[model samples]
Target: MSFCLETYLQQSDDYEVLINKAGFKDCARLIRFKADEVIYVKPGEVILGVRIIGVPPIPIGIIENEKKLLIPYTKPCHGTSVVELPIDKKEIDNIRKLAI
Candidate 1:
């Protein structure tokens, strides 16, 4: 409830970016180190109320009994990284709702 992906992306500076200007593959590789399972997402799809960015079929990692949704947020300069920030149940569910 406290961590909203949409709002965090806009209003906060309290998250960690492991890498920048990278790609989904890099993020996915990093996820393996932290998450228990991974959910691959199709390109041009929305999750956590935002459009997922990747080549195609991006990977989303979940952990701690689905309490967290690990998403790879990509930008033109900051390519992609597994956003290591706390998220709520509703946000996790939204990502599940759009899972491939």
Candidate 2:
């Protein structure tokens, strides 16, 4: 479960500083500070790091008939990027699993 910076960047259209698995689908703006960026996470939140995990196949439904399938639809599992504050043990575990 390695983290994928590119995917995370793409998913985070605004380049959000905070990204969590639970809110991955939802795009949120990031708050930057002179020391570092901050992303608010509630208690029991899960945050992963960037890394490459495995190869997963893409569904044909997502592919367009006329679209060029250049690169195999399969891609590695992408982890999320998050700030280190009030660090949660569980989030650390997930990041470790992803080798982030």
Candidate 3:
């Protein structure tokens, strides 16, 4: 399935927002600190149909037990947010391919 993060966030209640209206660096740190495993991707790499914005080697958090992925999402005026959502294996594999 093609997952649209924005649509999912708007229409579903299954996701978790770890932090909202925060800086990129702070969100990144929360991902690293909370997730079971951490991986890096380029700044503009797209995940869940959104372009991730951050410093070099942006962090993506993987929580194995919960089958969730933690990402720092940034918008024009909303600042950055750390969001966690359930992800399937296939999507996880796709994300791993973009790892730095």
The digit string of per-residue lDDT tens for model 2 on 1-100 reads 6544445545655332444432222212221221232223332223334232212211111112222111111132543333223323454434334321
Question: Per-residue alpha-carbon lDDT of model 1 for 1-100, expressed as tens digits?
Answer: 4434678767877666666666677787887677876777788686656777776667787785746657788777756767866666776666677667
Candidate 3 stretches with Cα past 4 Å from truth are: none
Candidate that beats the other on TM-score, 2 or 3, i.e. the better one: 3
Q: What is the TM-score (0 to 1) of candidate 3?
A: 0.93
Tens-place lDDT per residue, model 3, 18-78, is 9999998899889989988898999988899878888888999988778999988888799
**Candidate 2 lDDT (Cα, 0 to 1):** 0.28
**Candidate-wise lDDT, in order:** 0.71, 0.28, 0.89
Show the lowest summed lDDT stretch of 10 residues, model 2: 54-63
Give the worst 10-residue stretch by lDDT in candidate 1: 1-10
Please estimate how well model 3 matches the true structure, expressed as its whole-model Cα lDDT.
0.89
| Sort order, TM-score high to low | 3, 1, 2
